[model samples]
Target chain A: MTALTPPATVTADGVIVIDHLTKRFGPVLAVDDLSFTVRPGRVTGFLGPNGAGKTTTLRILLGLVRATAGTATIGGSTYAHFTQPMRTVGAALEAASFHPGRTALDHLRVYAPQAGVSDARCREVLDFVGLGPVANRRAGGFSLGMRQRLALATTLLGDPQVLLLDEPANGLDPEGIAWLRGLLRHLAAEGRTVLVSSHVLSEVEQTVDDVVIIARGALVHSSSLAALAALAEPSVRIASPDAAGLTRLIELAGWADRLEPAASTRPGVAVLHRVTAAEIGARAFAAGLELHELTPRDVGLEDTFLRLVGEGAIPGVAEPRLEGVVR
Target chain B: MTAALRTEYRKLVTTRLWWILLASMAAYMAFLAGIMAFALTQDPGSMTGGAPGVEAAPMTPESVARTIYTLATSLGYVFPVIVGALAMTSEFRHQTITPTLLAEPRRTVFLAAKMLSSVVVGLLFGIVGTVSTVGAGAGVLALMGEPTYLSDPIVVRSAWLSVVALTVWTVVGVGFGTLLTNQVAVIVVVLAFTQFVEPILRIAGGQFDWSEGMSKYLPGAAGEAITGSSFYADSGMAAGLLTSWQGFAVLLGYAVLFAVVGRVTTLRRDIT
Candidate 1:
């Protein structure tokens, strides 16, 4: 999990504001009234399942796909309004879009003039993404990972302030993923905003300081990663010969509201959430139940994520929702 | 537009496909000129069921040179058109437009750049085809002891005009490419129209006499008019053909029509 950083500054420039963005393809709603703000100074993860409209939302922001309703703006204006958009926001994965027959250097060089950057920037960015060794190679012969790197290099050519990357980690190997994480972190550390979208939680688990999670094309959870994990209570697990009695005593001791059977290979253990190990042992001592083990374990974000996306959410906690969406 | 054009120009030269296409088109033009030179060298009496010694027109050196000039464009115009179409549709096929649109998000500017660049390529195609045909045809005519009037002002004007005409035909191709982004579909339709459909319609129009007025407006006849090739009119195979100025106007109209439809589809629809 990422350590929570200081709140990002919401200035008139750099931050991205998505307000009630909606997109409809005939009757199927690709993006449904979605809204979120991606602030600079941190890497923000846009998490959702495969069909949760992650790509659609990103495309809408870049003006690749027009939204049916609402607005997605950067620096208080749409992407099209930017005088030189390549410098305002550089989107990766798009640069991967190239004529396969051209050399990688040729591919990058074509974009240099229009982006208002010098040809040297193209060469520099290729080196930045570790593609300088294969600069003369044809893009068609490149592996998916290499293609991803080339795309990232193109975005850097203009040295844009905000970056929008969609599923950039999809085809990357484990080492590539680690390198990409470090690169993204370094970019964010430079006070540039980075919005990376992926369906897998584990991929962004350690890299993202803040996350915008969605399900069925709507926002479900929006906050820091640590805050989402904190929603799940810390629990203690106990193994005893008299498991039923221990559970009964725990109920009588007033921790019943958060008690659960801890998943274990052995048969005599009940895990409790929001209950301390000391409290359970005290109650067990008073009830005269002998305990073989009393262990405290932390609940992970995986559990919180499952529940957050599922039909049934965690009980008694405020579920994240859009303005007009029903709980 | 200059920046975008420069970018597009760099993109075009980097790819080997464009170079290969240009070389092949030039070779085909030379082959055509060779065949025409051989046929013209044969005895005129042997070519026709002669009434003893009825000569085939005043076979002047200028007329023979004019025939070669018109043949260059009339026979080889489709190649450049296909190249233009492929240039436009290849981006969509490869999905490269995503990045292209991202760098320059405005569709109109990006597409206009493509169009302008494609026209310049079309002009290159014209130069190659015209040079190949005239070079080979004059060489063969000189070998046959026919008067090779390469210095004739009329022949010079027609040859240069044919090259310019070939370039415009390519703009028409760019329109076709944008109108139908599908590579195979555009190729099939263009081939069918130029090879079978238009030829059949032209013959049928001449035979039936009802559609003759419209056949003059067919792309092939308009091309012949622009090149000032009276091959069809002198042969009595076509009548009611438009003047050279009218042909130029009609060709521009077709280009505009193709461009308009393509612009609408591209502008209104999503790149995805």
Candidate 2:
């Protein structure tokens, strides 16, 4: 029951827009022609693997890094246009970016004034982030989870309309993660724009409403979580004493196209995509195939992420179809 | 702008570095002034002022007072510079610049606030350093049965100018620190340039009439000139220093140059 700021008025003011954002550090392309929109009232996950330009894109949006080409704006303007940026968009880039010598309160005090906040608000934010008990403790002695909480507290100092967090769940325990998920959902419900970035999709799989994924400095997929899940072909795992006969029976029934050759690692086993377990069971019964085991398997977000990044062996295909992927 | 300044001031006070620098600076000024006062009064002209060709002038009560009161700038200016430099470098050292810029995105305003706040702390450093040097030097002079000359106009002016000089040094530190983002590198450069390189050049400059003209414009000489009373200059060891206003202008020039170059070259660059 850490209470945060009152809900923001529902509007387009907190929307973050990035149009053809490209960044090049000397010879390396960090973000390439990236474009996306994070709207209000939703928890959008900016997902990508490590070095997939997730952090770079956030940095550009925050005005920490200069975009080589294109623009990133919040509320129809660049981050630099805001006089008191913290009040508009509070960002938590890295958790360990605290001065080891400063207490958590002192750290907040340093930015409170610039954010147009009072000293009492610093204490309030520390309390809201569940760090009220250790408000006087130096950040150096705190645990990683505590530091992460401190960073979040710092972002909440101004009660910003938008929150851009980079890997917020990095060093949290399971309980802490659950607490964070609730807090994020609460903030999103408050009509605030929450864009959280993480390398692994599973970490934020349960929390995010929309997903924007990238790989190798280029956009791969951007859609609702349900839309990404729709790309996953539902499959049924089947194991029978007459696996060869079952395969031939399915082939004869014109369901051979659904067979996943990559998933069938051994004889007497086959995985059929886009088919229900009951249909498979009825078909095996009709074919008089000896049954051993049949179970429906749902593809998790982790597999979808790996497949999107061209790093995982897609279900039925021997080679990953990295080219012409959904973008 | 006021909020930015307040934030920068808060940033300085929350850390231990500023107070530590102030304490050390006061101690250094007092000890150095005390030693120089004792040596000068005990045996006049016994020690050479290290001028290669110029004859050393014997110490008098008036000159001794002037030199002692100005020790804060002549010898203790580095402390304020360290204070100012650390203020900027700590952000980089801890990667706190991310949040700092997030709060105030205007780079020029952020740097300006840093400069202004450091000036405020620099003024404090100047007060402590001048007080210690004047107190110890006057005490030593009084112990030697010599007039401390505390109320003399030139002596009083030197004391206040010493404070101003140290304040300017603090601005110089901020600029240098901004230009050199690496904490260790900035510290090393500040210590090296102030302690070894500049002093050697200043001393060697006095050895020749040609170098003397140019050496008087060096940062240390400019600082000492602002006070209008350097132990070396007053004792006839170094000569042809700039007038007080000229010294002030020159010092401010250095501050502006370092700050502008740093702002353009490094401060505006991507902060990753």
Candidate 3:
């Protein structure tokens, strides 16, 4: 087996083809003509606002909900048509309950046979998620974080090449989040296709390689994280004893077009034109102006996400609102 | 298929409701037997004044055995129906069907496994109910100087066939539960049809010759046919009422019809 296998490295070429997928619940269109490709070996963050059809699209892709219009195929087959689905795609859509009275080991035991997973593999996955010690305990009393870990463990039981997780970090603490980031990275390194959907843009910033954003049941932006960040103009913040003098110097330097005062009550601080920190600093020094601080603010993923999804996308299309719950 | 069946069995075994239902069935059988035993121990001589009336006969092992079989089979169906209904309804109540369907994907396999498991559990409960009734009856009848021997083929066959009848009845309940997919609705429909409507129809069928054919198809009347009893003895149709084999076939047909309807509904409907 070892000699016949080549090294596992996910290429950017593996694509998830979603074509003309549409789903409607009465008057509301949950997912409307939504289409996107999540490439392999890259952590693709599916970002959207509270009711932007993120979860609905994922459900349709998983074949949990039938689409009203189109098709979502993974590796050229719908999830329902896959003969060895567990081996092809591992999905964790929601925090599912295994009989509350059953121990964790027993819970997995019932599913392992159907998934074609062995007993040893169950132990391996349990160990992977750090739940080996609590394997014999009833899952009813498990903490939310532990339940999330167990769900992840169940998802990994099939050793699938593709992963589709919806809000995998919802209940996790910071340390758990960090652990998840590492685990996802490790999985990607092993050439698996990992797709994660979350509204928390900051949480996925360092973890995801690319992003596919949607709003109002429509695609907003789809691109690499770096490319999206590069579109953001650099803003400079200057703190000086002489605000007037700094303003004059900045105007003379031909960077006064985008200049604005800093929105703070403190005196002697002004926001300058959207220019690089280095350029502003050199000009201030050249004009003999005293500058206490000159800092560059790089746009974060959150800024890009909000701007693309909140401001750019069309309004008034009703996506399924997760009432009183973070879905 | 075996894996699915195993999982279903595991789920049923682990559920507290299953155990409670089993205990309830046992308790009901014990209660029925206790009443019969108490009645059998009473002096038949005192009631008849040591004289034989035209319509009355002395209690015998065969007569008591027949009564026990009738009581056990008739009363035994309630528990199995309740158990079967809860088995399917709990998945919907707990919202566990989503994960189950996601795991299996093939809807038919999951449903078939559940149906088989329900039938097996129903069969087991039937046997337990029959044994408890017969054991109680035999012990009481023996003490009363009317001993029933195990070698009597008719009595043995009655007990065994009672089990078969009870199993088929439970499967019918399972099918109804699957079709309705609501615990309250299924239970209500089952109780209404079996208790009030069927009995009234059978009484009407006995009085009116035109309705006799219709009454024969009613579940309770059909059930009576299996137990070798006729709800309409005055109609003269009781003597030619369905034979045991025919009764078995009719019961099986009811079970099969319900099962197919349940299966189709389960497969076509959205689990959520």
Off by over 4 Å in 1: A1-11, A93-96, A235-237, A250-269, A293-295, A312-327, B43-61, B230-236
DockQ of candidate 3 compared with the true complex: 0.38
In order, the interface RMSDs are: 1.2, 0.7, 2.1
TM-score of each: 0.89, 0.94, 0.82
Write candidate 1's Cα lDDT for A123-199 as tens digits.
Answer: 77888778889999999999988999888877777777888898888778999899999988987887888899988
**Residue B237 displacement (Å), model 3:** 15
lDDT of 3 by residue, A1-327 (tens): 111112243444345778888888889888889888888778999999878998888877777778889899887778787665666677887775566777777767767766787778878788878899999888878888888888888778777778888889988999999999998887777677889999878989889999888887888888998988876766777888996886678668876567664453356676654688888878878888898988887767687778788775445645458886764
Best to worst by TM-score, what's the order?
Answer: 2, 1, 3
**How many residue pairs clash (N, CA or C atoms closer than 3 angstroms) in each of the candidate models, in the order given?**
1, 0, 0
Q: For candidate 1, give the docking quality class from DockQ.
A: medium
Candidate 3 wrongly placed segments (more than 4 Å): A1-15, A238-273, A281-294, A313-327, B40-63, B147-150, B183-212, B220-266
What are the chain B TM-scores of all models? 0.89, 0.96, 0.81
**B6-95 per-residue lDDT for model 2 (tens digits):** 999999999887898888888888899889889888866644645456687766778778887898888788899889988889999999
**In the order shown, what is each candidate's alpha-carbon RMSD?**
6.2, 4.2, 5.6
User: Could you tell me how far off, in angstroms, the CA of residue B97 lies in candidate 3 after the best superposition?
Assistant: 1.5
Q: Which candidate wins on lDDT?
A: 2
lDDT of 3 by residue, B7-29 (tens): 77766776567668778777788
